[model samples]
Target chain A: MPTEPLAKRPGGRSARVQAAVYQALTDLAGERDVTRLTIPAVAERAGVNPTTIYRRWGTLQALLAEVAVARGTDAPPSSSGDLRTDLEAYAVRTLADLTRPGGIAFFRAEVSPDIDERRSGLRECLQRATAGLDMVLEASRGRGETPPPAERLLDQIVAPLYFRVVFSVPDTDEAYARALVADLFSGTWHSAVELH
Target chain B: MPTEPLAKRPGGRSARVQAAVYQALTDLAGERDVTRLTIPAVAERAGVNPTTIYRRWGTLQALLAEVAVARGTDAPPSSSGDLRTDLEAYAVRTLADLTRPGGIAFFRAEVSPDIDERRSGLRECLQRATAGLDMVLEASRGRGETPPPAERLLDQIVAPLYFRVVFSVPDTDEAYARALVADLFSGTWHSAVELH
Candidate 1:
């Protein structure tokens, strides 16, 4: 049997508006200093009403955060029932995405400190990403398997990948990503006194 | 006596010029967008010849990297005899520096990918920082102590702290920094088959 429509159809008007806005914002970011980018500018470029943009995104930083997440980080691997398999796939996919052309920029934007104050758009992005991982973890819990904490997965697996990229450290390949996941499951890192 | 003139007084003319340039660069960075910041502008602001900056830093990115390092990361903990103590102290110092007012901005500039393409000034800064750690590790090795690899220390201790900050994961305080050091020496993480 065919898959369930390959996820929900984004043919709705809202989706179209989102695409247009994202495209306009990206074009504007490329053309000018992002510090000066405004919601009205993005709305104008996208041909969307400023009120619609304001009502939906509330702030320019949130829109940037959403775009960054959508561009690189939102596409986690489909769950495979086994937590290890799921996590490894996710780690590998994250690694691949980060190393792809312009992927680092998207990742950098997702964590950029400039956009973090007041509204905390990046934090929202992180929470949404964490929620996705939590679903996989919850499924493992339901199956009576002791999955590692989602935070641990992030600390051990996700953090290192971004660290290596941001710091320009070498050897952040698929092998390294797989090794991080392996270390998490090997129970080595968890053997300590569990200091949270 | 008097801490050896506070670790060698920077009274030389070259040192004076260095300070002026760094100050000027900082002032300029504050006044203008960093992307548009140039060496000539900094030189003019400092009342120094443009060739002086070109000869000393070679590039604007290198100068920025130096400023970032000098501003926060360069002052690692003075190496005590014990490796654990040194690493913990260094980690704690780094945590404090990153959390200080305007500290995270310096760090962001240090790892900012925008300045990373050509001269790799940030990499040089990283090497300098790593070298300081290596001195501590080397002293331990000289005392017949088995020191962990420098890269592992960076990945485990340093990477996690910066990751927590950059990603806005909360609770990256002194206690967390100390715990990370504790984890490193606990022999738990290293128990796994060394992938590297």
Candidate 2:
């Protein structure tokens, strides 16, 4: 029988440290305001030296961006092969995730001054976040249906969700999400604009 | 001849002090990072004592919010009685204003931590920002044409502009703003989505 030390194996010391640190930062973030969070506090909670976190992430904003990217890049909703079905489900889930605990912090972290440079962390995060919609659009095209540019989806659907959340708009419910999708597929943005 | 002192006239000393402070803050904001701004710096530039600023505005965030509200409440674009023409002009102006020097700072100030509470500074800013859109919609209704809800215009027209600004999306040009208004009025969000 061959035995490998836990520290020397494939899913070993480095991976464990990263997971622990991510968990610690998320837990701390949930417990207090994100503005007051610090490396030492996360290090203590993760039971690792603060220098390790500093060496790996370089800065707290980078760490937060890493966490946000991880969360956003999680497996996108499996496409049901129907465009409307996929879009409605995606929209509903996106709204739910944004309103979750520490969600706004994650969003702010992604767009914070230090990470929002075009060719860096923000770009990667945005790409990952849009992967699901791209997949859906591609599948619709394969089915011989013309799909809107991914930019249009971003403009009409995703933009409104974030806007309502950021601006504290009161009507950002599931029904509103459905209405947007409905209005999109219905060939009319609003009945009032039909007069034009 | 009227011999009233400037201090005793209608738009007198108090108003002058406020105008000076607003100008000083905007100039400073354009020249430096907003995170580093301080009341003493604003007071010095405005030629007023720091205590007077503190007493009048309560906090730097309050001063920033006041400046934003004043800028946003400026006369809305005159309605041209043509919905498409009016919307296109408004959208173009909105995008241009947001991209101006110190403009993003004004937006940040309106949505910053201490000012975002409902029924507060944010509410007033939003109301003032949307005033022109509401007027256009009302005129359309009066012309025996159905107009979309003000919120729809907000969702379709306003949200995307701000989202692009905040996220640093690169395609936020005059043509993009014009396209958004065109698509909204055309009732075809995109040539692709029409297949559904």
Candidate 3:
């Protein structure tokens, strides 16, 4: 028996509009604060009708949410069965994205808003990224590298990279990332249980 | 020997203006975005002449920078011989400050501005915090309770707490903080020198 090919969900006009909006957001990010980016400006820049942009996104904050989620979806997973290598790869990939022309600016915009809806979107993105890291750690343990608790992994390894990035400081380098992995795994590697 | 009170500096008027500006900034932070905050508004709220604020600080960014530095000066040092206890106390204190009314909002404003001068103030504050943490870690090592690599202490122990607080997430409780201490001490405490 032959297996069925995965069918693409029909996004149609909405998908095209989303792509255009994301492009506009990225473009605006290079020059100014994303919060100051108006829907009409984005529509004009993307060559879409302003009415269509508003009809679809409802608000600039809503459009920004979709764009933020889409940006994160593009990151490929890293699991090489080595925790140190995997984490370093994760850090490097994250650092590269954050240091890109629009990345840090986008992050700043996400958190700057005092509104709950906008803040929630940013929080959700953070939660997803953290969950992804948890999976990486789980995979490491499955391969016989019993690591410390998830909270610890988050605290010691993942959090600093972000602190440096969002706060606009030096990137947490390859050496620092690797040292984090080694420190976590030292003798405790034998005790780490694969997370279900 | 009893020392006489320090002589007042000739720049007392400038100092008073700076203090008043900071007071107005803090008060406005409770209700408005620091980005949109203006000199005339600050002077009126602070009960000082607009010319005084401008003449003393030169610009809004300069005044805000001074305020940021002043806010950071009161953070307690973290050395108490015991890394776990000291770090936990520090985390709790930092979290208390971050969650206080106008605290996180004030931080967001200073750090989120796209201008380099505004961001430099935040960077300096972070540097000071990092330096203080480094001192605490060094003290822990001197006690033979901490293992070698310095970066591990940063990545594993301190980084996560800072991340959670800055992101406005839930606090890392004492139990989790203690586990982090145990993980670092057991695993990478001795690995720092080896890496070098």
DockQ: which candidate is best?
A: 3
Ranking by DockQ: 3, 2, 1
The candidate maximizing TM-score is 2
Q: Best to worst by TM-score, what's the order?
A: 2, 3, 1
TM-score of chain B of each: 0.66, 0.83, 0.69
Better of 1 and 2 by lDDT: 2
Off by over 4 Å in 3: A1-17, A31-44, A47-60, A78-89, A137-148, A167-171, A174-176, A187-196, B1-17, B30-44, B47-62, B76-93, B134-150, B173-179, B193-196
Please identify model 2 stretches exceeding 4 Å from their true place: A1-21, A28-58, A114-121, A188-196, B1-17, B31-35, B38-56, B114-121, B188-196
Which residue pairs in candidate 2 collide? none
Candidate 1 residue lDDT tens string, B1-196 = 0111124555787777888988987776654234346889889989999998897677675677667656754474566788888888878876765665544445545545553341264576567657767888898998898787787777777778877876667787888889888866664555564756
lDDT at position A38, candidate 3 = 79
Interface Cα RMSD of candidate 3: 4.2
Judge candidate 3 at residue A16 and give its lDDT: 70
Per-residue lDDT value at B95 in model 3: 53
Query: What DockQ does each prediction reach against the true complex?
Result: 0.25, 0.27, 0.30
Point out where model 1 deviates above 4 Å.
Answer: A1-63, A72-76, A111-119, A187-196, B1-63, B72-76, B113-119
